[model samples]
Target: MSVLEIKDLHVSVETDQGTKQILRGVDLIINEGEIHAIMGPNGSGKSTLAYTIAGHPKYHVDSGSILLDGAEVLTMTVDERARAGLFLAMQYPVEIPGVTVTNFLRTAKTAIDGEAPAIRTWIKDVRESMVKLRMDKSFAERNVNEGFSGGEKKRNEILQLELLKPKFAVLDETDSGLDVDALKIVSEGVNRAKENTGLGLLLITHYTRILRYIKPDFVHVFVDGRIAEQGGPELADRLEDEGYDRFLTETPVG
Candidate 1:
């Protein structure tokens, strides 16, 4: 089943220079239980695409449609999109000074699930997920993303993914800024989440390093704010070997 669909989507941002178009008539469809990786160079609108799908308020869809599970999502509010089973893991997680991780997780759970899990059950689940992510139990009491290392933030996002178990997740460069050990641990957490919940994934990344750990069923090359090319897992290997030079040359600019 097609869980998410982007048809002739155009997105833009307002700036001093006026409207700057980011995504230009981009089209994509992600089915349930599929892993799709979108690879691109910097400023190719990879993150923009993810944020747009998740209904970020800053991004405006200039034209076209985004549908989640057959419903028009472009008209929905950000929280409404989340409640509709979409999740976005940002490239950079923001830190909230006063919100502890446990409190934040429970609040998000309450919002999404319409009721928070019992305190005891929630704590137990959080601890188990933390241990699976190779994190210490003390992390539960720490502020969300505050004073956390790059790897810690990434693992925390995966931890939320596990706890919430969204039907579809858009992971925007989750493997960036991590050491080998952290990468392995984050990859393990992601794999475990997918295995446990069969979550569909749209992974946005530039390097193929993470692909080695979390295999993708389909690979797409985003260039000039649109999907310039797409293929199976072999496409990622080709990009790894040949680089994105051809895509840059072939991609059409609107």
Candidate 2:
């Protein structure tokens, strides 16, 4: 079953200097219980694609359609998209100064699932997920992402993934700025979530290190705001061996 679909997606940002086109005629499809990796350089619009799919207000879809489970997601609001089982683990997680992680998780769970879990049951589940991510219990009491190291924030995102159990997840550079140990823990959490919930994943990243831990069913090379090439895991290996120079030279920007 196709869990998520993007057809000819074109996104642009309104700025002081007119609208800047980011994603240009991009198309992607992710099936249920599969892992799809979007690999590209820094400014290739990988994150833009993630945000556009997640219904980020800043990114206006000038043209195209996003469908989740056959529903038109481009017409939905951000929270509506999230409630429809689409989760985006942002590359740079925002810090909520006064909100504890526990409070944030509970509110989000209530909003997404339509009811909060029982207090004791929810805490227990959160603690277990933290343990699986090798996170300390104190993290639940702290403000969300405030004063947390890069790895800690990433792990916290995984914690939410476990708690929410979304049908589809877009991990935008979740492995960025992490050390080896932290990377393994985050990847393990993702693996466990997929195993336990059968969540489809669209992992966007520049480095191939994370792919070493979490094998992808399909790997796509994004260049010039569109998919330059796509193949099985071997595509990732080829990109690892030979840099993105070929993609850059061949794929023209629209």
Candidate 3:
């Protein structure tokens, strides 16, 4: 079984004031086909963990290791991590000014697979994924995320997830900026990808709305840059009702 393990991870970033720590010894394991939801308040380091796993240059790992199938992910470059079947769906996807969506997706798929996809099959897959995400065919010709709405950008992210078929995906606040219909559409896309690939997921979010569509096998409460509590889906329901107030009260922010 494929496994992604985070062991005593400590990450820091340079700010205007100076170096400030974000993750403080976060340890977790995600097995293949498992969905792990990380619910936390703002500044709780959920996004930091996602970026660090994807090997973002901005977040420096002071100590600890991220292992993918026993391979050290911390040492791998960003693209290397993707090639190794690790994917990150950014909260705020950036715009690629000149690259068309078709070209960008194909390029990324080629990079990860180490070969150009067969044009016939690749075109079919992309079109099908777009249709599944409720995206129109015209999006294929548009520049990547350029002039796209928030919902459109999110669907684009999921489109990549479905096409790339990574072993694991860290969705950093993917539910943000989505309306009810858009949320359901995006969540369905994520679920479809997981079903097709058996990809493990680390879903990070503050609200529990997304959890209704994409059920999590395990729910973790992140507070003060660490997992304060964890449980089954019932925990998410509890948090929905009680909110993060209890966690915020118990755990002081760093």
Top of the candidates by TM-score: 3
All models: lDDT?
0.91, 0.92, 0.95
- For candidate 1, give the lDDT: 0.91
User: Could you give me the TM-score of model 3 versus the true structure?
Assistant: 0.97
**Error in Å for residue 20 of model 3:** 0.9
- 1-254 in candidate 1: lDDT tens per residue? 64788899999998899999999889888888889999989999999999999988889898999888889998899999888889989899999999999999999999999987998998889999999899898899999999999999999999999999888999999999999999988888888878887888999999999999999999989999998988999999999999988877784642
What is the Cα-based TM-score of model 2?
A: 0.97
TM-score, candidate number 1: 0.96
Give the alpha carbon lDDT tens digit for every residue of 4-46 in model 2: 8888988999989999999889988898899999998889899
Per-residue lDDT of candidate 3, residues 1-254 (tens digit): 99999999899999999999999989899999999999988998999999999988999999999999999998898899999999999999999999999999999999999999999999999999999999999999999999999999999999999999999999999999999999999999999999899999999999999999999999999998899999999999999999888887786332
Q: Which runs of model 1 end up more than 4 angstroms from their true locations?
A: 251-254
Q: Estimate each model's TM-score.
A: 0.96, 0.97, 0.97
**How many clashes show up in model 3?**
0
Model 2: pairs clashing at backbone N, Cα or C within 3 Å: none
What's the candidate order when arranged by decreasing TM-score? 3, 2, 1
RMSD of candidate 3 to true structure, Å: 1.6
lDDT (0-100) at residue 194 of candidate 3? 90
